[model samples]
Target: MSVSSQHEGLCLRYPEPLGPQANVSYEAAVSMLMRAIQLAQHTPFVWGYIDKPQEGHIYLIFMTQQLPFPPDGIRYQDQEQKIIMPAGPGRELEVMEVKFGFVPNSSDTTAWRVRRRYRMHKGGHPQLVLIHYGRGQPMPIMPNLNQPVRNYPLRPINEPALFVMGEKIGQKVYPNQHSGPAERPGPPGMGMSFGGIGNQQAMLAQQNNNLEALERRSQRDRSGSMNARAPPPARIEDDDSADESDMMSTRTLALTRYKRNHELMNEVFMYAAFSRKKEFPPPKSPYSVFDIANVEARVAKMTAEIDELRSKAEARREARSNADGAVGDDPGDVSMEVSGTTEEVPT
Candidate 1:
């Protein structure tokens, strides 16, 4: 028998029997055997193997749910008699049993049953049991072994791994194909089952397809591309007070006056230093021109205002230059100073 990497190296070369005992001493023997399996290399999360006298031959029953491969290439030899019980999946061992004589056809059985119970702290874990029955002996009452299941999202395992966790029940099985055994035997050396090893591979493939379909539907829902309606356009109300338009018109007139004042100021400054500067024209009416003393007073007020604006502009420019220098000195600081004065000089 060839050894497999997945289940190799864990083999026990027991010149000493792991369980060398009698049928009457079966309970004690199983207890000792279980402890040995626990200490063995690559001890599966939950598993056990025991030998007991049944009929004429020693019934070597090995049952496990966690191990990837069946215990193969491992054996017990009665050195005194030279009898060898080689290890293989159900071929050299009994397949597990749920109840005595429930379905007695194969010499070796490896059946398993799984039940899920909700846990307050851990959420959920599978309760797996593997029981094997020897010929003409009542099924042994086994202790419940607790193993932490990997609560991974259901996905298809490849052909090899699927064979390891063999014959999954409950949520582990997939849809399609009748729920029974296969017509022909599966691949060579693989166990006999509803669809053999191929059934498990098919079940995994179907599970993958189902998950892919669900993911596609979830993506479509997230994109909001299914029977969705666009939002309505925002509406504007035309209802406003009759004086609203009048207010806008007044604002426009004020802006026009401000612009005209700016143009007049520029023209006055342009002529201030010109040799051909025109003389100030008198108003068409004497009332518009005002008395000479009043005109002189208005000119004096305008000159004072111009001087104040120049002082403010120079101060603002100096402040901005200082701010620029500060910014250059401190790379992290931001300067937000106005560059020049912008006083609205009333005419």
Candidate 2:
């Protein structure tokens, strides 16, 4: 994946090694990446990819979100590489469970209070957990094994990345069919059921009673299904020949909303230094409102403030240490002594 040269510094890299056991199938990775792209276009924030290196190492890189496509009189770096086709919508996706906690430190109370001004002394990092909800085995999210999830406020690209973490699921959508799994098989594959059928001894006595009870339960389920609103119609995955590699064919992944990075808006203000044919330099951030002149200077001022605070903290610590040391080294008796003679009272 290529990145925007101007927004290069916006991303962070984690070179932690992902073990081979955490391998995500190629198709699932592609689906997640595609969803990430969709999220970047829709949301006005910084985002990037959790990439897998050749050795299957997990390397995460983030960047400022860019507009879905280049504005008029502007061209993107991968202009020719992007493909656009009319498509229905993304599937419903799952939201993963995010647990936040504090990182314990050994510093004393005074020092901790001082340090907290600049950063989160305790609650900065979050523990990622699997969203299995007890369906099967419990899965913990490790840097190497777990893939990053891309969530959108409105809807997902096909479905949420949480459900299709490692590989894609569900049937393929068609142009003119309902897209939900209305008649899919049961949880443990088709033609399977738990509990045994009644034997002749009890079956004969409760024949009418059992039939009526089963009929009522089935009716209730059907009613509940009918009452629920349906999503956009999609074709079912009835094609047995379609494998992981063949999925998502005849689908176009494109941006749903038009974000305003507004490259063309500034062209009116700046001098006509270059022709329209020349590609404009990418913005440092996605939104034009945040592109301020003194952004760098403000960052430097914050850094200076942090340094000053650090120095003050060190001074306080040094003074406390010196006072303690002097008290310990003094030769005079530290205990209070009672006076032997009493002084005359003054009027």
Candidate 3:
């Protein structure tokens, strides 16, 4: 019976692939080596690194000259050293063990950590070995590598390399026969950034200015002023309040003009219909011409009528005032005072 001890970085056995009578193959060995190499390659080494040739593992030091202190585990592995893969479970006695310590070199001392693990399996035209991002544990044993995993590196080199290197390796791994011409630059023509909402906004503003100018001109014309040539004021802010106000004002002006035009048209139509009626013929005087003597006579008659009305009003007012004054001044006396000058005498 195999006894297991657990620790921070302890490597435990894989379940199905373990137990008695399990055969290990060259392919398994190669895969395990690849896994180890892949882990190390992905594990970045900064100013210093450790070599553990005995366990077939490497410890990378993460104390650079630039840093003030040796960072914590994940920080040491990830940020300071810029390593991608994490250190796995470290155990002893057939389990993956990572030995870490600080080795002082001159003025600075760097912390070093290493991870290692292995398993054996069989049965395939080409046998399968699997590795992934976890502390090695006995589970429904790691899956067969024959089936592909998407977005995960298949081989060890893939985990460490950059995009360009991966692309080249990818092409090598799965060769394609098809070839094509190089891709061309961006969109055609005199390429300008004026094709979007900015252009539309500018155009709308210009149209609004034109509308305002026309509206001002129309207002001036309706008021019968030739010297009136003024444009609408500029909008100060580009916020919701300004937008709502502008829209409301524009709608009001449009409605007003529409109503005015409709009324004018209706009046014109009514006048036309009335003029065509059989009872009243068109006026005989297209532009009525009257003699100067006739005009003078009419003016004199109008003046005489006005004067008569004015005299009557004045006489009434004077009579009312005198009667009131006499009544108040002498209640017992009711005397009548009449004069041809109706303006002053009571009737």
Candidate 4:
């Protein structure tokens, strides 16, 4: 089947062979063009021909990345005219009229020779466009507009697997809500008075403390039991083979631990590098564990030092000002004495 036949539902009503001219409605033509462009998004390339018998032309619509300029004598507000059409429910498709062709020739197939003009309707309806082309011109060759294949980054071989037991690695698995302890009943007269609410809160706190203590005790007991049951160290054998086997086992264990630690260190370095480049916020320090007393003592010491320095600077300035004033007074005194001597000599 022909491409047009395959997309018959798209409302493209073009004849198979080229007659002198083929007649198609403006609405059907626009619908076919929009649909073809929409399908081209998923494919590498798509092109189709629409016959406008009324204008005596055949339009060659093809996907292209380059913006086409308008022919001479025709001016547009923008280099490419954009037309918005409804694609699907709650969706709009934007189509650009990149190129306009006026002159038609049989030799150059690459040049767009058909003028595609859009007309807006009076009422709220689908807009229509009139395409003009030469009557006997053959279909133009499809442009080489295939999109370049994208190159995506591959995961590193050393990167750990991201799946575990049908769950993503490092994904938090929260305990089921039903599996948690049942909600305790509020104290008698709870929510009626503040005292009742306080009592209930205190009771809950005590219960939580008791549970934590029990858990800690059980853990300690389990560790003690395990330690007590541990077998005594094996006696050294005189045989060389036994000693060699023991050494080999110890070396293997050490190597295994070193490898594990190396992997962990690599993960930490990678995270630190990424965090630095990304400028992630530093983790907040716990206020409960902060040494507020030590900070306050240091701050007090700094304040005292600052005050002492300020006092010393003030004293130095005061001394300098006093010395300046004394020097000025001496100069005035000497001048006055010289004037008195001159007056006496004249007498």
**In terms of TM-score, which candidate is strongest?**
4
Q: TM-score each candidate.
A: 0.15, 0.15, 0.14, 0.19
State the lDDT at 19 in candidate 1. 17
Error of 2 at 176 (Å): 55
For model 3, which pairs clash?
Answer: 9-89, 9-90, 10-89, 10-90, 10-91
Each prediction's Cα lDDT score? Answer: 0.30, 0.28, 0.30, 0.35
Candidate 2 Cα errors over 4 Å, as ranges: 1-285, 334-347
lDDT accuracy of residue 210 in candidate 3:
40
lDDT of 3 by residue, 1-347 (tens): 01111111212111111111122222333333333322222121112111122212222221112222221121112122211222233311122233232212212123332333222221110111222112222222122211221222211221111111111211111112111100112122111111122344553344344434433433444354224435424533222243233222343335445876889899999888787647767678743676878989999999999999999999999999999988787656455456743353255
lDDT of 3: 0.30
Runs of candidate 1 with Cα error greater than 4 angstroms are 1-10, 13-15, 18-26, 30-66, 69-133, 137-347
**Model 4, 140-200: lDDT tens per residue?**
3434422211112211122111111111112211223110111122233321111112344
Window of ten residues with lowest summed lDDT in model 3: 161-170
lDDT of 1 at 173: 14
Q: Model 4: residues >4 Å from true position, as ranges?
A: 1-30, 34-58, 63-86, 89-287, 290-347
Q: Could you give candidate 2's per-residue lDDT for residues 1-347 as a string of tens digits?
A: 13342222212221112122133322232333333332222111112232111212222222112312111111111112212222224322222211211112211111111000011112211111111111112223233322222221212122111111111232332324321222222232111011123453332234334323433443554466556756335633332334322322221111101112244455655656544568768866656567466887899899999999999999999999999999988787445434965555444
Q: Is candidate 3 or candidate 4 better by TM-score?
A: 4
Alpha-carbon RMSD, each predicted model: 36.3, 34.5, 34.0, 30.3
